[model samples]
Target: MIHVLVTQAGHLEETSKQCCKMSETTSKHTSALCTMQSLHLVLLVVLTIFVYYVSKPHVTEVQPMNRFDVTNVSYTVSMAQPTDSIQRTAVSERTYVMVMSQKRSGSSFMGELFNQNPTVFFMFEPLRSLTSLAMKKTSFSFETAVHNTLNSIFKCELTHVPVSGWVVKKTEVSTCFNAFEMQNNSVLRQICSKYDLTGNQMFLNISSTLCKRRSHFAFKTIRITDLAHLKPFFVNDEFNIKVIHLVRDPRAVMNSRHLLHEENLDFIRRKGTHADEVKDLCQNMKVNIAYGQHIPDWLVGRYKLVRYEDLAEKPFQVTSDIYNYLGWILPQEVNTWILRNTDHDDDKAYSRTRDSRKTAQAWRKTMPFPDVLNIQNKCQDVMKLLGYVQFESRQSMRDAKSSCIPFNGYLNHI
Candidate 1:
């Protein structure tokens, strides 16, 4: 079974990183006090040929009402029983999903989780589509011609490549980075093995399902949450598309980020405009629910908002939820399998001892108080609206604010 979890977080990441960059120059006192870090993460995200839109502000989390036709939602949520006469959805056919987000956070983690399913396959981020688009816009280059065909297929661009025996999928590169994820992504090989697929062959893994029909495949380019406006690319009814949205507390997100250096904005293009930070974050949560608010929502109270803390503390359970969402009963062997597959148990095992827990408070200890306030204040409205009280109680704030990133203040020597 090919299970899918779509996490859309393009600009949310770009914004925070840019915050680090601008904060360095914007604040006079913190410039030297705060050792300016390098810009690897930000650069990695920007230079990515996949090109999602974080340059814009006030990123609109797509509400169901924004686009989904009720009938289309029905198609997405429709389930086919193994014995049902309603015709089994074609196999050997492929579906696609784009793992999107600003840099950091857990988008990559989810992608890895989904990839683990034996039934799915992927191209981490071939930059196939973006390269293709650029090639067409300019003149086709040898480097991009192969992918330019891929980009054309995906963008449904001006050029039309004949659909032979394959599909072109366009998704974010973070999804392809195997550093945190693993899966039996052999459908590509299987398809190529089973069929004499041609260069013109194309289909899309819009639902992230493996091509049971196995054929040579490639995902062109997908819309990043920053480039969220492009979501309509998959919003129609003809092809069944499933979307997953992942959100973590902004606090802990900030903690993991402090370990990283700030990136440069020259690489990022400011496309969208901003209105309110907190409101946008809150609405993003709502948008996640609105699109896939099936019976038990995925975030809170039906919605499954995987707390990064919980995910790290209890990876199996978190993944079980993910597996379940993808409509699969996780194999009982998952625990032993994970142990054998990777060194993830260490990241998951809960740290014992008060000292260990205190060490986890790196964000609070290292981030200057004002930076914390800036992060909280920026997202404070969402905090309240989502039933997460503002940053009043430090202990609860630390515990609850484990989803997103926070601001970094002056550094205390480790």
Candidate 2:
């Protein structure tokens, strides 16, 4: 009986040991499963965070504010974000003005109107350098170059100029001086020296000075003909852009081209024959003028079509109206300059320096009757659209009974 009891006790001890081993094995398995689950959960969280970051909208560098008072103004610009390809945020408030016109269409004269304003930082034919740069960088489109350059100028972000994607030549900064005729301007000279851009430094670092002052920025471009091409600029909230679409009578434009060609026969020869040149010019004028006919709803207030004739015929009134349209208070200095410039009588053959008032009617006298007829015939539709009266015959002028209905479609604002 004692031997049987001892054997039973040994069996019980063996069972207990087996139970302990099983429990240790189960705990190890459970711990391994828990660790794997925790690892998976951590991985899932990391992936979620990465996806959220990747899906977020892209935000471009914020445009710097004007140095002047912008306490009351707020600008919101939408740009596609790089990461998620979504547009977010608003552009800052900086006024940008562009004079859109064709060559020899009184763009220079209109540009001068803005140039005379002390508050305006005017850049004339800024596209010339851009075009040159675009040619070198074949990968970059001309439109893109223009867009970037204009934005940089308006934002006073000079360092953004000669951007690798748009500009191939870093030394193109000298072009600005040539465009603005700043070589003799003392202020520009001082600024250049301040930036250490004098002498061998052809590239400009304009940020040190130009960006420090706040002013309304303006530029004139004859390079762009289609209004649609400027859509990017118009929609960009970074700039409160106003467009002045200047148009001249086709007859006047033709005559001016003819006269200019006559003066520079070599240039005319290089371009083409007189007829071909005039035909091309007239076609370009027609296409560009027609762009104004159907102004987009978004552009109604932002775009203004101004006839060179109207501006010349009624300088003060038209200018005042322009100022009002642009939401600018015509400064006393501007008024004084206008008065002083327009008061005099101009009698020059072909001088951009003459009193602009005389320039309005000079086209009528300068263009021969037959040539005027040709131009009128070529541009009849546009001429009529722009309120230019065409007499069927010279006799109709003497009769004073010719049908007279001025088509002032875009001029309703004036």
Candidate 3:
């Protein structure tokens, strides 16, 4: 009986030891599971953070604002010439304006609206010199030249601008030298600094001096085909840039081009009154207008799209609004200029002054019916977008003297 009792006690002790081993195994498994769950939770959090950052829109570095009393500041103008006007002002913030458009889009006329302002230093087709340079395959790439030249010009570094870009009258300088040639030959760079307008240093010095004194700078260009090309300037706060994207009706633009015997265009590889020409023109317009509509953060207040038709219909009203946008009053001189220019009709090919309202409607009366339809068919989407009315019949288009363009608030809002 005693041996049997001892054997029972030993069995019970072995069973307790086995039970402890099972408990320990279960505890280890529970610890591993908890560790894996914690790791998965940490990974999930990291992945979410990565996605959030990746999806956010990129923001450029913003310029520091100059805090000053607005009540004390005022914009003043000193008219230099009918062509050249310089503004002298107590305002610290310099305004840089660009009138961007395609050729024969009445850009020259539209530019006059800003150019007439005494408080503004304006250049006409500065990039036209660059276009001249592009034909020669100069040292600077087209993009580089455009960016550098504009950067220098806006900052009043006139010497850095291509000498060809400057408007020194042929009669003004007795000893003539080709600045474009000097630029291409690198003769100016070797003689002076890299960006010396060495052909006539005096004119360069004078223009630069006058430019530096101005509170505002404006330039018009038909060279820039894409709004995306100006992204660098838009992103840079130093520029304080305002873009006036001037767009005209494709049919009118084509008619003007054809009338001038402009068989070749800078943007088109081969140009004629064809599907390719109108298609390319409208496509360029569409891209520019689209960019203006869906403007990015950097371009928020800096960009505006101006329609030629609207400006022609009411030059004074539109010009006044433009001046107001620039935080300046429309001077009496600008109004006078507008009055003189818009009221009179001129036969000259490149005349800035014209019966502006009549000029806008000339296409309807002169352009061949088939040609108008061709443009309308090619640019149907752009026409719809810009609120241009397409004529269903030749008689309707030619006979109607009143404005065909409806007031599209979406396109021409101040």
- Best by lDDT, which number? 3
Pairs that collide in candidate 2 are 58-81, 58-82, 76-90, 76-91, 77-90, 77-91
In order, what is each prediction's RMSD in angstroms? 32.1, 18.9, 23.3
User: Measured by TM-score, how close is model 3 to the native structure?
Assistant: 0.69
What digit string (tens of lDDT, one per residue) describes model 2 on residues 1-414?
434544554565565555555656688766565555555555655665676677679987644334333332212111111122111122243467898877677887677677677666666666656554554565868777777777666655555555332222244444333323443122343444444443222332333123324356677877775677777777766567888888887766767767765443322323434546555555665665554566676566787788887776677888898888888888776676677766565544433344665565566544567876776777777766677788676555334334332334437733
Give the whole-model CA lDDT for all candidates, comma-separated.
0.38, 0.58, 0.68
Worst 10 residues of 1 by lDDT: 405-414
lDDT of 1 by residue, 1-414 (tens): 011111223544554566667766577655433333324344544455334333335655332111111222111212111122211333213344444433344554445454444434344443424433543454544333443443443332312442221223433232232222123233343333333322321213222222222121223122233323434444433333334445555554555555555531211211223344334444455444344334322222222334343444456766676556555556544454444433322343211111222333445645555656766777665444333334554554456446332321100110
Task: Give per-model TM-scores.
Answer: 0.44, 0.62, 0.69
Off by over 4 Å in 3: 1-92, 138-140, 168-199, 263-265, 268-275, 409-414
Candidate 3, run of 10 with poorest lDDT: 73-82
| Superposed Cα deviation of residue 124, candidate 1 (Å) | 2.6
The TM-score between candidate 2 and the true structure equals 0.62
lDDT of 3 by residue, 100-206 (tens): 88888988887777666655667777666676567666464888888988877876666677755554324234113444323321112222332333345544554
